[model samples]
Target: MNSWIKLSVCFGLCFSIAGCSSLSGMFGKDADYRKNEAELAKKLEMPPNFVLRRSGDPLVSMNVSTAQMLEEIDTIPSFRAEGIRIESNLVERWLVIEDLSVKDVWRGIEQFLASQGFKVEERRLDIGLLTTEYLARKEIAPVEQELTMISRLLNSWRDEMVDGIYDRYTVRVEEQASEVRVYFSHHMMTARATDTTTAWRLRPYQPMMESLALYRSMLYFGAQQDHALQQINTQRVYQEVKEADELVGLRLAATLNESWDYLLTMQYRANWQVERQQPEQHLLWVKIPQAATADQGFFSRLFGSIRTPGLVGIKLTPVSGSTAITELTLVVEEGNLNPKQRQQILTDLGLLTE
Candidate 1:
C-alpha cells in the first residue's frame, strides 16, 4: 500500500465521530477515549469553566503603533465576526474567540483572510516558562492466589462495587516561559467522590461507571472565555490591536500601583518630538498620553490590547536589556497625570532634558 494510503487506513479504523458533545453519554469499556479524557481532566485539577491545553506563547519584542499599522489594517476584511445575524440586519461587529490558543489557528486563517482582502500582522512569539506539581495519591491492591482470600478480603470493602466510588484524575497545563524560552508543565489532582450511587450494573461495570462520572464532572467545571482572540473561517488570531502607543502611559502608571500621589508636587518639562520630512504632512509624537483612569486590576486587560479598557494615545519602547516584555506605566497630562506621574517616566528614562 502507498505510505499515505496506509496511514489513512489506520486512522479510518481509530477515528470515529462519537459522543464528542455529550459528557454524560461517553462511557463504555475499551472506550479508552473518554477514559483518557477523564484521567487528563482529573490530573489537572481543572474546575468547571477552567481549561487545560497547549499551544504557542506570545512573542514579545516590539511595541506596535496603531497609526503605522492602521492604514495596512484597514485593508483587512472582518471575519467570523460573531456569527450573529438578527432579523437580516447584518450585525456590525467582529466575531472573536479570545483564547491564547488562537495562535495555533491563525496559521491558515491569515491565508484565508488574505484571499478575502484582509491584512494580518503576525506578532513574534515571546518564549515563556511552565511549572507543575502533584495533588494526590492512592493505594495499590495486591493479588492473591487463594480463591477464598482473593474474593473475601480486599475486594469485600471495594468502593467501586458497593459505594460506587471512582478515583478521578486531573491535569493542569501551565506556561511560565520568558521572551526567549518556552516551558510546558502539568500538575495533577485526583480523588474519589465521597458519596456513592447504585449505578452501572453490567459486565463493563467498574471502569465504565467511573468513567461516566468523571466525564460528567469535567463538563460541570470546564468552560472558559477567549474574548481577545479573533477567528475567521477556521483560523484564529489575536484581534487586531488598535493602540499600543497609548499603552505605554497606562503601563507606566500601573507600575506605581497607586493612585498617582493625588496631591504630590512634581514637574515635567514637556518635549514633543515633531518630524515632517515632506513639509506637506506633519508628525508630532508624544511619548506619553494621560494616565489611565479605569482601574485595570479590576478589569484585567492585556497590555497594548485594543479590547483594552480605552485608549487616550500611545508610546514606543525599544527592546533594550532593561525593557521587560511587560511594564506598568502611567504618563500624566502636562500638569495633570498626577504630579508624580511625569516625574516617574522622566526619571526612568533619565531624560531630564532641561
Candidate 2:
C-alpha cells in the first residue's frame, strides 16, 4: 500500500510539471515579428486602381537649363523658373524678369495681388496698369523689450488699441526689349487726432514699404528667398542731376536704349497717347489733353466735342561725354504749354530716372 501511494504521487508530480510547460509554450514571448510582418503585408490587398508613384530623377546635367528640364517633364514654365532680379535707384524700384512674356507677368502680378488681399479697383490691360483699393488696418504695436512687472501690468490695463492706416498700391508692367519690368508705387493715409476730432489725411510716400512689397512679389514669382532678400538689400545708386526750378529737361544715368524704354513706360503711366515715334531722330510725338477733359472717358472724348489736344515733342539726346547718360527735353509743337504743363510732363517722365 505504501509503494502504491509513492508511485501515484510521483506520477501526479510529473503530470503537473508537464502541464505547466505546455501552458508556457502556448502563452510565451511572441514569435519573430519581422517574419509575421512580411506575411501580413503579403496577405493584405491593395485597393482597386491603386498605382505606386515613383520618384523623379535625382540628378540633372549642368548643361541643361531649368526651362529645358521643365520642357522635358512636359510642365508649364513659371516665373520661378525664369531669371528674376530687382533693379532700383533713388526715386524708383522695379522687378526685372528675363525670358518671360508680358502676358505671363501680368497674370502672375494679378494672382499675387489677389493672394495678398488687395482688391483691384482699376485695371487696364492695354497699358498694363493695376490699382488696388485702399486697404485699411490697425497699425502694429511697437515691440517692448525687457518689460518689468509694473510695465506689463500697465500695458495690460491700457486699451492696447492702435490707430488705423490705409494703404493703396499701383502696379505697372512694361515689356523692355527681351525683359519684363514690374513697377510698384504706394500711397498711404493715416488717422490724425486733434482736440476736437480725428480725420484721415494723406501720408507721405514710404519707399521701404514699397521695397517690402517688391520683395514679397519676388518670392511669389519664384525667386529664392535668400536671393530675393539679398537683392532687396543691395542698393544701386544712380547719379541724378538736380535741375534748377527753371530748367525743364531731365538728366538720366541711363543709356539711350534705356531712356527710350523709360519714355515708353512713362507714356503708359501718364495715359498719354503717342502719335508717333522717330527712333532715328530720337523724338517721340505725344498728345496731351487739357486738364478739363483729361478725366473724361473714351466715349466722352469720342462723342463729345472737345478742344484739340496739345501736341508735344520729346527729344532724347545722349550726353556729350558719357555714353550712359541721356538728356530728355520737351518741346511744344502745336499748342502752347505753360511752365506748369511742361513741368508736369517732365515730372511724370522723371519718375523712371529720378
Candidate 3:
C-alpha cells in the first residue's frame, strides 16, 4: 500500500508540471501569433482612392491623409475576441468595437443601462443615438474623522436628509466600415442654494464618470475585467493647438483636401445636418440641433422650451505656401450662440481648438 501511494504522488506531480509547461507554451505562442499577424496587416495597404461604404449608406471616397488612412488600416487586424478597445484624442474618448454589429452593440448598451437603473428617454437607431433620463443619486458628504459632539449630531441629522446630484448621458453609436464606434457625452445637474430656494444648475462635463461608463460597457460586451481596466487606464495624448476662447477656428496638420474629408466625416459622426456644401471652395453649412446646444435637463425639456436649431458655416482654407496644413474656421449664420454654446458645438464635432 505504501509503494502504491508513493507512485501515485509522483505521477500527480509530473502531470502538474506538464500542465503548467503546456499552458506557458500556449500563451507564448499566442503572443507571437498576434505579433506576426499585426506585422502582416501593416504590410497590407489600401490605395489612397479606395472607396468605403457603411452599411446601408452610399459609398464614400477615401480622400483622407496618408497617415490617417494607414492608421485606420493597421487597426483592422488587432481586434481581440471581445472586439473592443478605446480610441481617444485630446478632447474625448470613444470605444471602437469591431466584432459586433450596430444592433448587437445597441442591445448591449440597453442592457448595461438597465442594469444600472437608468431609463432610455430617447432613442434614434437610424442616427445611432440614445439619451438617458436624468438619474438622481444621493451624494453623501464625508464626515470628519475627529468630529466634535455637536458636529457628529449635525452629520447624523444631515445623513437622514436627501441631497442628490443628477446625471444624463447621451450615447452615440456610429457604424463605419467594419467597426462600430461608441461616443459618450455627460450632462450633470447639481443643487445650488439661492436666496429663496434651491435650483439645479448645469455642471461641467464629468470625464471620470464618462470613463467609468465606458469601462462598464466594455465589461458588458464580454471584455475581460483586467483587460478592460487596462484599456480604460491607457489614454492617448495629443498635441495641443491654441485657439480663441470661443473656438472660432483651428489648424490641422493636413492639406485642404484632407481637411475637407476629415470635416465631412466629423459632420456625419456628430449627426450635424448639412444644409449645403461647396466642395469647390471647401465649405459646408451645418445646423446644430437644439438638444445638443442647450444641454437641458429632463424637466426643462418637459416644459416645452426647446429652442430652434442653429446654423453655422464651416470653411477650410490651405495655409499659405504649405500644402500639408489647413485652417478651419466657423462662422455663426443663424441663431445667436454664446461662447459656451459655440464651444459645446465644437466639442461635439471633436474639434477642440482651444
Best by TM-score: 2
Better of 1 and 2 by TM-score: 2
**What is the C-alpha lDDT profile of model 3 across 280-309, one tens digit per residue?**
989899976654445444323333454544
Q: Candidate 3 lDDT (Cα, whole model)?
A: 0.71
Residue 39 shift from truth in candidate 3, angstroms: 70
Instruction: Give every collision pair in model 3.
Output: none
10 residues in a row with least lDDT, candidate 3: 52-61
List CA RMSD, all candidates.
29.9, 14.9, 21.0
C-alpha lDDT of all candidate models, in order: 0.28, 0.71, 0.71
Candidate closer to the true structure by TM-score (higher is better), 2 or 3 = 2
lDDT of 2 by residue, 1-354 (tens): 999999999999999977764664567744455666898987775542233222333435545577876665653233554789988753477999997799989888998888788899998989989999988766557647689877877887545557567788999999999999999998777666779998776654555567778889888787888999888776443333344655456677788888788777756655667889999978999875443244324324442453344677988899998998888777766555444555555544434221
By lDDT, is 1 or 3 better?
3
Q: In model 3, what lDDT does residue 305 have?
A: 56
Go through the candidates in order and give the clash count of each: 50, 0, 0
